[model samples]
Target: MTNAMQLNLTTPGSNLTSYIATANSIPMLTAEEEHALAVDLQENGNLDAARRLILPHLRFVIHVARGYAGYGLQQADLIQEGNIGLMKAVKRFDPSVGVRLVSFAVHWIRAEMHEFILRNWRIVKVATTKAQRKLFFNLRKSKTRLGWFSHEQVQTVANELGVKPETVLEMESRLSGRDVGFDGYQDDDDDSFAYAPAAYLQDVSEEPARVLEAADWSAHNEERLTQAISTLDERSQDILASRWLSEEKTTLHELADKYGISAERIRQLEKAAMQKLRSALMD
Candidate 1:
């Protein structure tokens, strides 16, 4: 089963095949219908119009999302992200642009899907800038020849894409690389010492100085909090203890019952205690 839970705002248990079938079943709208829906959504924020416009084109998003299935991501997630882009495009689409809704939506759909791909494409992001994003898709397409690009070909791509040859080379390098396992162990190979992410990447968590700094920071914050709490009045301190410091926080009504006061009084006391605590902490 395709993981539909990864998607957003789509029907439950809706697979790509099912989504395609449903969307394709809806006839494509004429220019008049498409324009009317776009105007309703863009001018009046008619959610119904938005839904109507989006429903018919959902399959198109799924089709485009299918093309990006090679990135080892959940298909439903890509479709979901594409759906968001489609909705955004629908909201901004100007019917007077002399283009079909599909043409306008295509850019938005691909943009959202591309963002999702780059963010989750690897454990670490491969593309952080517009140029890198362009390189990412183009580089993948360029790799269709089944070998690395020659220096001359790299220069050609660089010139055509209006980027430095080195930038093209760098993006290509990042694209060709795969995520390495941090630990040295591998299930496929018994050789425990070979092909480890730990070997190629440094583990900052292992640094004693950094570890100590984090520990010290946590300890100091705890001490400061204790000092701040001590500065509060007896009633305010007790209120804080009962409301927040306890393992089971006391609700306003519960505290009010204990204090023989209204819930509003308890709330006021709680707010005043928080203000005092904030001031003490700031000092």
Candidate 2:
């Protein structure tokens, strides 16, 4: 509701242990107190009531955030995101539903943390689809021992998660992979820097010698092709041009109609013209 209130509850700048202690020190609300706060907020749009509802629940957010510790994100940031979810739950909470705030808020809290993990976990996203997202979070827990999953283990995980074995394998691969810098790390020494992708990968397209050679070769072929086409009869030349050289190529049927011949005859003429051009270019 207010910066002061959030800082008092989270104290995000402080060390993680201190933040956890502060969150745990906050008193829990009784059902009656929680209900009253929910009613006040829902009826009157009371920010203070919403803040009270959120304070006692910061501990629960910390607990949920701790479960995601293996993801390599900062515990403090995860807790902060979970706190935001708790606040959203507090605002939209319906006491009339006969559910406690924590039970209702768990989904919202985990949702925010999951989003943070997916976004920051990899430079490339590991999960884009709904099934992939489900597998991304659950795959690590499904593995009993590490390294890689055996075919049987993969199938087991797939069945347990209601996904295909291929999906399980793909998500497992993604989870196990680490992001590497394309140009190599800044701290890399001379020998290591030479092995980096930027050092070894060449962009030959931008090389002046290669560029000039390709252009010259293309021009030489074009000159030979023009000379070869000149040796063809007028009809053969026109058909060849319309069929192969024009921007808007003429269809055999169109050529047939124009020349008062059957489409088969047009095809035969085209074939003969191509053979003559090939022979001339060879010479």
TM-score, each model?
0.40, 0.43
Candidate 2 per-residue lDDT, tens place, 75-185, comes to 888998888778778877999999999999999899778867765868237877666767777886776454478898888788988988888877888887876555432
Model 1 lowest lDDT segment of ten: 1-10
Off by over 4 Å in 2: 1-6, 123-283
TM-score of model 2 vs. true structure = 0.43
Model 1: C-alpha RMSD to truth? Answer: 18.1
Clashing residue pairs, candidate 1?
none
At residue 81, give the lDDT of candidate 1: 85
lDDT of 1 by residue, 11-32 (tens): 4144657656656676778889
